[model samples]
Target chain A: MFKLIKQLTSLVAVIAVLFAFTTESMAAKKSKTLKNTQKKGFVRCGVSQGLPGFSNADAAGNWTGVDVDVCRAVAAAVLGDANKVKFTPLSAKERFTALTSGEIDILSRNTTWTLSRDADIGLTFVGVNFYDGQGFMVRKSSGITSTSQFKDGTSACTNIGTTTELNMRDFFNSKGISYEPVAFEKADEVVAAYDAGRCDTYTTDKSGLAAQRTKLSNPDDHIVLPETISKEPLGPVVRQGDSVWEDIVRWSLNVMIEAEEYGVNSANADAMKTSENPAIKRLVGAEGELGAAFGLDNEWSLRIIKQVGNYGESYKRNIADTGILPDRGPNELWTKGGILYVPPAR
Target chain B: MNFKLNKIIPQLVTLLVVVLIFGFFAFNAQINMDNRGIEFGFGFLTQESSFDVQFSLIDYDGSHSYARAYLVGLLNTLLVAFIGIIISTILGVIVGIARLSPNYLIERTAAVYVEFFRNVPLLLQIFFWYFAALRALPLPQDSEPILGFSYLTIKGLYTPSFVWENLNIFFYSIIAAIISIVVIKNYAKKLQENQGKQLPVFSISIGLLIILPLLTFLTGGVSLDFEIPVLKQLSTTGFIYEGGLSIPPELIALTLALSLYTATFIAECVRAGIQGISKGQKEAAASIGLTPNQILKLVIMPQALRIIIPPTTNQYLNLTKNSSLAAAIAYPDLVLVFAGTALMQTGRAIEIVSITMLTYLSISLSISLLMNWYNKKIAIKEK
Candidate 1:
């Protein structure tokens, strides 16, 4: 009996010791995601499962979109290699949880920077990359030119748990027009339902409309209405309480925008390093100790521009040139009548 | 004494280990949540949901609380389960009996049905119904009226609903009729047992049920008006039905898949129960010179039902739990509305998941308890 008791006590002690060691190590690892990411030699980026011109994969499994560019830019800035990124495709419903649970280091999934998501979900939105607004798409044969022409009992299909649903309700109620919202969890379902005539209209971001329109059987049959209902400043996101990691992601995006503002394209980025412009010198790490502030190398911005190009190049190549959404209404640099402005790198 | 000590000590140590592991998990979760600065509470249940459900049984809007949204989801789930249970039972009994038929075609047909539906995954079946089959339906403007009153469109099935007047008085009449019938049935049963006298209790009960409700319509000012659906054009091409009850295609697809899938299992259970009965029992009934109907009602069925019911009740419970698959096709059941959308909106993973789990657990427990009571009532007594 004494032997059994001693053995049991020793087993319990051994397990307790192991548990304590694991918990202690986990606590130590939790505080330094940047270091862990560096050690892993890749940044795990959470992206949308498939949204063309935003974050979509091709037949060859190569991910390329505006959101995908943000991930590559971050990888270029942090690891000095644009290919040092692993994209984990996530649905809108699981995006925040995945980031908060440390399943992914950054969520560049074209997620909206909503107040509740920022304040309540333990996530921090870096900055807006795509300034979009919710719009409606209807068949051209419907003869509904504007949103005002939508009468009572019009049914609209949209994705559930998105700002689109709330915007649809608010738009109809504010206009005194009663409409039914047929919501689905997945984006593909919404498109399928709309195509099947299960709904009279479809509601989503204007960019989403353009991207998803390509999937429709007759893309030319649909028209996006002119009225923009809600502002969706889609941006990258990071877990809260890690100011260092948050700054790394935020500045990586800002570098791209600033690169465009400084007239720095991928073609001229290497030659522009020797230019006499103070802001250009600071951006390319030819002057100043700005990179030390975010614990990155001095040539972080230069690597980003060289690997992923400026914001204008990414937007044009992935969005405009692809004919998914050719309009760059408000995404151009602030100097050229748009809102793509960022703080100076100093 | 040593043997007893050994057993008790090991059990106590195992209990301590389980408790310690649970405590360790709770402690880690708390620390992790604290580190992330996420507050844990159920206070958000009373907050405005600010999210609209496409199809809800109750009067719900975005202004309602999350608690109310939960109720709407719970009610929708219960509705699917209730409808699925009724349809599956009827189909199951028919197919089960058909499988035992002497006719070759009927037996093969029953076998084919069981083999087909039972092998396919429920989620895929739901997808096939919601996406492929229902999508083939016509638009509202192009839809042909069924029986000149209802319309079936890709949007939904619009059926004529009754606008009832004096509904409470009609309900009271029904209750009164049921009570009187029950009293009469007890007296008749006593008369037969004590004096060998019988009464037409079944016919009398049916007569009361119909007459009581009919009398309310005539004398109590109870009226019902049918409102048929009418197509209204919003634009050149947009059309929708007005003034009727619209059953969304999600509900139809969900219930159809659930019932068809569950009926296969129930049919197998019924087949097993019937086959378990001995041929001697049938011959023994014939020897007593009883009629075919009497032998079936008093001998075979009563015994077969004793075996059939327990497994059938298990299938009913399975059907209820499987209704969670409604989330896949966006039917807005408890799992979709409360767990999927609400959890995403609130970002309270622990609270929302636990509540959803507990709700399903309670539903399953209550149903099993009811089935146990029914099984006890139908169980044979040995004297």
Candidate 2:
């Protein structure tokens, strides 16, 4: 009996070692989501259903926007082509689940970075691409020029599953106002209801209000009230647990901002590889091995810059050119009296 | 022993495989969730929801917990289902009976309604009613009162809210009337069976039902009043009716679409049930000196109900499940408020989804149980 017990113990030890070896090899093959993306040859990206100047698709099925450019930058870095991205249009309620469930590799849908979302959910916000604030839009005929003019029994329309709902309550509760919240699951329905006079005002991120304002029957008739209710830092997000993939997305966005700061546009990116500034050379993949960390060629950042352009170019082409919040507001560089700043990529 | 082993071993192996498959899936999900740092638990239900809803049956606000918000959504869903069931059952019976009518126009019309409504998808019907039909209603300021003080407008149907004094006394009076009517009905049945006597039970029951509730106003200390809606303007073009029980246009559209859609199926069930009753049963009842009404009520209806209850129960379950589409039109039903909004807020996908599935399963099961019990009560006894 003792001899049999000893043999069984030996067998258990051998099995444990075999299991350890299997996991160790498997971990290398499946270190994260990067291997899957590389094998698939396209970056799976999640975007909003349709928010013009952000992630809306054109009549020809081409998607272009600052938010779309983020995923394009990632695609260029990892897959060596900016256009190698398949966009999945998601609702406000579905974006996070789509990302965390491996349905999409990157979620660049103008999602706000909130404490609960960043820390609690299985998601990581890469960085902010747009700085927004919640505001109310009322018809010009109402003569309600400001949020202070909103009266009791006023009905507000908004999308559900957004921070806008919570902020609207805060704005009302703080001001001691009793308002009706007509929350819809989709942005289009909210706009429709608000347009039909079912709601006294519409509320969302100010940028969203502007983009959606263009869809109204008479765009000039509705006016967004000048009151910033809540700070909304919108950005791209990725699934947690894949630090390599997370860093690749984070630095891809960072590289775009850094290029813009150094006055490097897509037209001048390839030529600037032989620049005097070490920072510029490093950005254009002329000086350092920055791409080694993400298991890619040294030209990853350069490809991102050459294909998707810099932060300023993305903003100008997608947002300013489209006539949606053309000013850029606080999204400009820190040197230009704005808050757009990122760490140096050494 | 060998025969038993042949059967039991295979069964055991099949059960083992099923359990192993389920266990593997659960284990894989747990590992993935753990790796991603997503804690799986129901602790979030007790946290503050901090979001406002458009309409609620009970008191609710941002200050309430997540559990309360779930309750609000559940109540709204139940409310729609309850109202839809009642309206559909009434319309279904009429259409079912009309289909059997000798007049070609009546039968054709019923058939057309059933075919058109049942064939067209329910989601599109809901969207049409909410976005197009209700969208055509006038704004509050432009609304003209329909049926006296009630106003039908884009906002909602603004009807006078009933305010009762000593409402409990009124309910107690109603209970007393119902109990006495049941007693009288049983006694009258016994009298007819034994002595060939008859009583005007229908008239007596109706009189008792009306007079008891009415008597509460004079002697039982029950009084009632109506608070009529008044139109008020919020802005130059924004207006709403105040001081009444306002039925939201969302609820109106959802109820209208659900009843119209489900009534088609229920109508088919009813028609099938009535047709299942044999002509011999009707002839036998007529030969026994029974009137047409008596033949239908005593012979045809009792037999027909056995078939009707089971299928009608399925329709009820379908209607309840279909009501989840209320999320599309902003009706604040279970899917919208709890599964949609609450799931987004908490990010508890696994937990919230499971709870929602269980809730729906329980509702369907309860309906099935009630119908099955009733079916058994009316089933033919083998003895």
Candidate lDDT scores, in order, read: 0.90, 0.92
User: Tens-digit lDDT track for model 2 on B256-285?
Assistant: 999999999999998999999988999999
Instruction: List, residue by residue over A267-326, the lDDT tens digit for candidate 1.
Output: 998888799998998888888977777667689899999999999999999999999878
| Candidate 1 stretches greater than 4 Å from native | A1-31, B1-8, B191-201
User: What digit string (tens of lDDT, one per residue) describes model 1 on residues B219-312?
Assistant: 9999999998988999999999999799999999999999999999999988988788899998999999988878878898888888999999
Best by DockQ: 2
Error of 2 at A24 (Å): 16
Model 1 interface CAPRI class? medium
Q: Pick the candidate with the highest lDDT.
A: 2
Lowest-sum lDDT 10-residue window in model 1 chain B: B327-336
TM-scores of chain A across the candidates, in order, are: 0.91, 0.91
Candidate 1 chain A minimal-lDDT segment of 10 residues: A22-31
- Give DockQ: model 2: 0.63
